[model samples]
Target: MKELRADIERAGLDTLSGRKAPRARVLLIAGRPGSGRSALAGELVRQVADRYPDGVLRARLSEPDGTRVPVGRAARELLDALEAPAPAGAAEDELGEALRTALADRRVLLLLDDAADAEQVDALLPDNPDCLAVVVSAGPLTGIADVRPCTLGGLDTKSAVEVLSRFTGSVRVTVDPRAAERLAEQCQGQPAALVLAGGWLAARPKAAVADLAGQLNADLGQGTVVGRVLRLVHASLPASAARTLRLLSLAPAGLVDPHTAAALAGCSVESARATLDDFVAHGLLHPVGGSSSPQYEVPCCLHPLLSALARDHERPAELQLARARMLERTVRLLQSCRAITETDSLRAREKLLEMPRSLRFPGPRAAADWLRVRRPALLASARLAVADGELDTLARRLMSQLVRAMVAHFGTRAAASDLYDVHGLVLDVAERRNLPRERAAALLNLGDLDARTGRTADALGRYRTALDAGREANDPYATGRAMESVGGAHLELGDYDRAADWFGRALTERLARGEGEDAARLYGRIGAAHTYAGRYGEALRNWRAAVAGHRRNGDVAAQARALSELARVQEYAGRLDESLRTCQEAVEWAGRAEDTRLQAALHLRLADSFQHLGDPASAALHRGTAERMLAEEALEEDSEPEHGANACEIRSSSAEE
Candidate 1:
């Protein structure tokens, strides 16, 4: 930090007490790879922390290979950092605008580390001058205007020696000053190289610095000095640990925990964890903080080197086997997670118990927590699995399990947006494998997500394609679901007549399959569609048939649902007396079914009917009853049961498609 004091002061940034100057509030810290640009950025952050009291926001703008991360993803990360709500399915321009607005009037220090080019950084720059951005890249960001550039070279010898001392201890460096100088010189005075050299020496306390210096000069004569040092460090590890190090390059987020490492190395969890700890001890991996379990990440600069080593030294079969193990482990874990979430399914409970204890979660909450923590890695694995064509079977099952797990943890509607990318991957796999059923399922799921996220046109298109696929597969379940989903989408779009037509077709499939209970449910859905279209007579007929079917099936809850819909249609048709009778019957069935919410809703319907009939005293009585029932149930309006399935309702726009 002291080495950059002159550059910091020369930037002419305003103090906290002063108004920021009307200039492009960006600073460029340009340097070559391995020149410690990121380290300098961190030091700058510490130095300027007090000046920017609002917050310090940091985002990685590029991969280690200098490939730019998508601007939209970067924008989303920034919005998350700011704690701003990003609208679902929003475009890049909208997200950029939100980010600019979030930065306005705030004193933030935005650190965009390892930026690839000018366009990448320009889009994320804050419009507010009060905010400051420090972009660290390999060269000056040419297109961005009004920027101050601070080019970084190799750390001077003194700073470089200080870097080594920090890792290996001052006593060690001082005891062999010449050897230490020789090592620093070998590193070309680069902080990154020095840190690796220092870490290697720090790990072997008894090894002389001079001997190690001679080994570096003799062997590892190719590649950058840092790359060769990494290879030396890697080669020094035990075979098991070395294999673990190479396999970790496959980790999706460049981060791994004990369980993931164990899966990759085909070792016991304890052994993999110990290997990870040893790697961290030797500075081969860096510890990433804020995890329940200890987590370590391979440094980005070492990725290509490690990957190359793995390819050269490890068999393709071995690597593929390792990846298969990871996918299988992930699939099992997700299956267990989904099992626990099926609170009402006795069979699911039995299956959960049958799973290996290691795969099983203690409870649903534990499963949910794991899902939240491992979402990124899990998604990344799914993507890679799909891309690896030979793993299509595993990928398909993995994606199916993920969707189920997410639905269980986050509910269908809430999980849809977050799992959108996974659904797309599922579609890709389905197309590649020519699995019509899977393709239909993926499209239907995506459509449901689009519907919930307000992409009406997209939802309709997905539903239509899903319907075609379902028909081609000759899958009744998929076809029925797709038909109903199309109706749901039309209902969302206010195309009530079309919704009724689709719902009627779906009902025909359910009835043909002799799924009496499901048919009853679909009848109610068809009734809703008719009601929405103001075809009260058609609604009444379908609801009456639904009521009869539920009665035959001995489903009191379904009977109550049908009768409630019957009452609604009667009221809409101005048959007040009939509606009152139907509502009373619905209330009786609701009480029998112990559905307090349904009872409250029926009472509310009775109240409305009485009020419309000009009977204020009766209306008040029913209204009071409705309020008391709702209070007893503690029910919120439109609140569905957290457990148990319900008849599909073709509700208004607010319904989940």
Candidate 2:
């Protein structure tokens, strides 16, 4: 005990004697909930907080029972403790500004414990950066942009043992060090749990350490809630606060702000804020964000129990309503992020007309930024909405919107893998619920992603699995799609024979399904494979078949590609004039496809044809146009960088949604 205290004090001296505060002075004591944050706070206050003697005040931003606490009420409580009489009905901003004024020159150590987010921390920051403030929260209080953050994690084995030994005698720990350490590990290194167990052991002098460990292990095995004491405190809250706590159990993000919470609970923001304050007073919540809106979080110590209880008691109707409202908002935000994709297009006015007032985005960039900011919460919401146990069709729609929005606004990497995971989860639930189409759709979507990212082997496996599953389920469309993906993967791996075989199989399936467009695509793949294998005769035959099929189906894009291949074969066959004429027709078809890459390729090929025939003027004109178009394409791609701006826009937009 003596050695540990001495070491802590030495470290405290190191903390206290450091340089003066920066432009933003925030001491964030970050750790997971119930890791002895309060005890550590008190120790730091006693030892080193004296540097600021103006007025050292303590505030509990989160309740011990795992609920959100509000900032206005927290500020009022701080003011009351500081002996500063606040006017009745002071708004949060007024109270926050007042608190700032009170601590401006005082150099007080404001110990805001269990803070939920940066919003609450920002509200209480001293006007004078010289004033030191220790803001403790479960996670990083990052919303406050430039503040210095000191994150704290779990205690080490030695410190945890020493702290517990303070209650259980040192002789007991020394005599059974291994048992003592194992006990600490079983407690998950949570200081509060260790302290409680150690105190109970201290009262029972005859209790063996091994016996206690066995007892705890037994309780865990039996699901008797051995690590659930933190939830009992939550269950003891008043009815209003308890309901608020349960509603927050559905919070997509780990933290919740007042307005969104109000929306979820079908109450006013003031009511939600007041409920948060009441819970904080009762030690049931923690205040999270303060930079923008007030937010709160349930401590991790209380999370497991609270989650289990929620699973048992949450109201289905309320949850569904909240999920639907959140999705509508997400759809609006997604449209905003894809604003550029619709500019000057037919859908521009239609999209604008469909947008909701709540969809106010500063710009397309801001909309994109929101997605990046709220990616985790968006993902969680999708998962939770699917598990609503009702609204299966809406779940499908939500998943589709999620996929479209992710691919459009942030590209494949945004949620492609996560979407695949969620789709799998959804597929399982849907199959159990007897929705075969939903299962097939999810499987086929995931299989598509698996193939696109060069996961040829994995894609092949997924395609085969989905094919068997869909066939068993009598879903011909999915079976056909799966065969196509399997063939695509083989093509990517340069397995010409296997690729052609799979493509033929897919063509048969699509033809049976009467899917002409898809069958044409399969024929084009067969032609391309033959070309890659240098079998010009077989390639020419396949290309003619593909061109005939695509023209019959009026698929200009496919026809263009087939015509280009046929022209190349003719060029190789020494029929220069006929090849040049066919190349011109391919260029015309390429323009009809409206595909920039194909258009560029056709232009380059046409230029080569002209150059081969010694037509310098024609060749020069084509080359210049291609070069100019390529430069413009490169500049456009570089204009919006893939990193900071684009990613931030997506994140920020999602937050708004």
Most accurate candidate by TM-score: 1
All candidates: TM-score: 0.89, 0.56
Model 2 CA deviation exceeding 4 Å by range: 1-33, 37-238, 258-260, 268-295, 304-370, 381-398, 509-514, 552-558, 572-577, 591-597, 610-621, 632-657
263-337 in candidate 2: lDDT tens per residue? 666676689888877555444467754233355765546555556666666766666676566565555555565
The models' CA-based lDDT, in order, is 0.80, 0.66
Please report the candidate that would top lDDT against the real structure: 1
TM-score of 2: 0.56
- Model 1 clash pairs are none
lDDT of 1 by residue, 61-90 (tens): 875434568787788778877878475556
TM-score of model 1 relative to the true fold? Answer: 0.89
